[model samples]
Target: MKKITFLLVVFLALFSCQKTDSEETNPLLNAVLYMQQSAEYKALTLQIYNNAAIHLERALADKNWTAATEQNGDYQNLPPAVILDVDETVLDNSAYEAQLINSGRSYTSESFAAWCKEARAGIVPGALKFCTAARKKGVTIFYVTNRGNAQKEDTRKNLRRLGFPLEKEIETILPRTDSSDKGKRRAEIAKRFRILLLIGDNAGDCFSGFTHASQVKRDSLVRVYQSHWGSKWIILPNPSYGDWESALFDYNYKLPQSEKLKIKRSRLVE
Candidate 1:
């Protein structure tokens, strides 16, 4: 936890002079933090749960006609499947984050693995009911996550612990093996089922397995899918790290601490 807070402090101090107008305007996060300090993000998470439920119900019922094109360079034709990214969208591991953050601890793969074994995280705002409903509607629920293969047991235990429906008999939770290009896995899954819905926190998670794309490619892909943003692909807010932030720094996770701060600070719009 100390390490997590230290990273946060390092972030805040370096970027303190550059708080973007949008960052200052992020009300939901403000509310979440306030609720956290005052013992409230839990309530907000519950509220999220209700909204998640509502969103899923609406999506399932929306028989409205629209055509979506899958632009994988190789296999152009894809079939029916609703892909869901794990972590903040379906499973709420904020408790794990909270445990680290509140105690000022940083996350270790091993410690997180242990946390998964305990299986105590909450379901994201509306995820449990949403996934269950999709399954009942005969929509195949494919949990395509960036979590590594090594973390499989804990991820699965955490999902079942939180009551997420495991539709696939073997490894309903698919982990990232090579590049974080999630679309590759999505393509593999699409070979079997037509992906109807793509739900996740990160834009890459929804952009068909694009972890390693250049900034231009990422932007182009976003433009390609702009029409389907809130309908076929549902994006929930995640205030912390993602490829968007990484892109700004060229995905250089090995940068010196000060240089890291400088790069992120450069991008902060005041």
Candidate 2:
């Protein structure tokens, strides 16, 4: 009788430990793991960049192949350029995301700024090769990131350390100043150069309407510009974080993590 009681207690304790372990799991574990470890992720990034190279060759052959919607009127004679986003586009910041997971905290501007200042981010797969090839072909590479102007220097250091091309005579790293609408920055680039491609991980990187847009509205815009996905606008996969995740919670970053998780879970199809 005592042996049976001891066995029952042991089983209950083991079950309790399992339950606690399951509840304590970090939500970002799988996403970060995929980005850091998966061969499939590497393959996908390589494929996207290879496709971009092919399309770039095509765009260079033609003078009128302007990628930005902001580029209008007599741009055929302008020097060719390519605009790309920094975070998760050219430089991989998954290490920062991994830090957040380990620390059991949500994202904060202060923390992200600290990370940027370190300028230790790894390069995204195939980005270095692609950028180098494009620069060699005489295409001016511009990084139009929404990272605040304060991060511009550190961002440049990171890019330079990674051996990506940077033109000393021109401002290649155009960080956000007064607006997060990247279209204005693209327009600034368009003033002097013919943009051959716009590459990034977010929809806003490709066009201007995606800022703070809802999921439904974002999908609508994606359909509206369906023709540009693989060719003129190349997007790298970013499941860890982006406007897509924020759109699920209605862009309410202030919401408690639990509430945001609940809303995200509710959106999942059964």
Candidate 3:
């Protein structure tokens, strides 16, 4: 946590004399700091995972209890599995965001891809314990991530190093092969395994129709499926970045930083 804050301080100090406008406007600085430094962030993640543990037991006892909206047919007879989004849910990649801040740049595919390939991400708070306990109870763990297929091995290695369960006989790491939306992948998993829980940091991780949706629409969808939250679906705090952030900018990745910040500020309330 100190490391994250130190990086930001050094970045700002390095430019204190020159002080370019861009240097003063890194939006990710505080978010990354909170993710790294705050006891509240750690507490929230631990609380969510602790809730997930309770729900997992309930789902196991009641065979009819399935988390995925994608689950259908006679899934009770199938093997049980928990589907989790990789980044921010199980893995903490705030270091990568810190790197972006230090470099005075926004996220780019190339930079993120390189970071993933490094396989140096720390596990999210309580993720290792939750996943290990779930695996011990004979629930198969499936990582349904949007990371590109090219990074699959590195992701698997990272998870393995962190003591997360990985089935040798089963290909559990499902990375993005076609589209970024994960609905199809979840549906495919549902066909084979009774999904006991859907855990992630993004709304899109648990349900479809959230990608690229407007802020109001996303909030409405949350209400539309209000019952599922903390029951069938568990969400981790990820204010640092997600579709929630993109929705503020209307999913316009090409928008200038100033424009994006303008849109975000306009949405704020007293």
Candidate 4:
């Protein structure tokens, strides 16, 4: 009887330990883990949007200016427009991130689509205000996102529900159809309007060669466009996930979570 009781106690203790470890084993935790939970993130987002507002005014005054480096000088006479990434740039999907963390699940398209269908995403700190100001200035707002075209209606519903300005007769939201690289989409918009500024959390949103580039190549490309960082290309903070994380893993998505984590830790400078 004593031996039986001892074995039961050992089992209970082991179960308790396993439960605790499982609860704490989320690999998504990092310095930016509390970004949505912290005040600093809000402030930084506000600052970036405010700066964008100021730059937009300046760009409007200079009809000859085009934020898109790929755009030729002839496009200066076209109507003004701003290209923005929907996720993490204009929309606060931190709730989705929180859900992933709480559920101990990595991001999946189905889950993200379900979240979009719910349309519960809130506006980023100053996104609405900046976008509103840009619209009032008669500048068209183009949302060029990598979200699959299958999610188009839900994404539109979410953006419209959040009171984002959308074009009346023309579709301004461009979703991923064939490629993840947005250079072609940007060019398509550039042909119609003079792009004033490009805003996003990922470098790929603002420039080419950043989509699947290595860490070294990405850094080199950033340096190559050193002058465009703050002026024409406004980047929001998104440390949770992006091409930045993908670069750490050599853009290989097939790696197991454990291997990806190992690779990430190995790449850390500290």
**Which candidate ranks first by lDDT, i.e. highest?**
2
Cα lDDT computed for each candidate against the true fold: 0.65, 0.93, 0.92, 0.89
Better of 2 and 3 by TM-score: 2
Clashing pairs in 3: none
lDDT per residue as tens, model 3, 126-158: 999999999999999999999999899999989
- Which pairs clash inside model 4? none
Clashes of each: 19, 0, 0, 0
lDDT of 2 by residue, 88-139 (tens): 9999999999999887778998999999999999989999999999999999
Q: Which ranges in model 3 have alpha carbons more than 4 Å from their true place?
A: 1-24
Off by over 4 Å in 1: 1-80, 103-108, 168-170, 208-210, 214-217
Sort the predicted structures by lDDT, highest score first. Answer: 2, 3, 4, 1
RMSD in angstroms, all models?
9.0, 2.5, 6.9, 2.0
- Residue-by-residue lDDT tens digits, candidate 4, 1-270: 999999999999999999878766666555336567788889999999999998998899998888886788588689999999999999888888888888878888899988988887888899999998899999999999998888888889999998999988889999997889999999999999999999999999999889889999999999999988888999999978899989998889888888998887788787
Which runs in model 4 stand beyond 4 Å of their true positions? 1-18, 30-33
The Cα error of candidate 3 at residue 47, in Å, is 0.6
**TM accuracy, model 3:** 0.91
In TM-score terms, candidate 2 sits at 0.93
Least lDDT summed over 10 consecutive residues: which range in candidate 3? 17-26
Measured with C-alpha atoms, the lDDT of residue 36 in candidate 1 is 36
The weakest ten consecutive residues by lDDT in model 1 span 65-74
Q: Is candidate 1 or candidate 2 better by TM-score?
A: 2
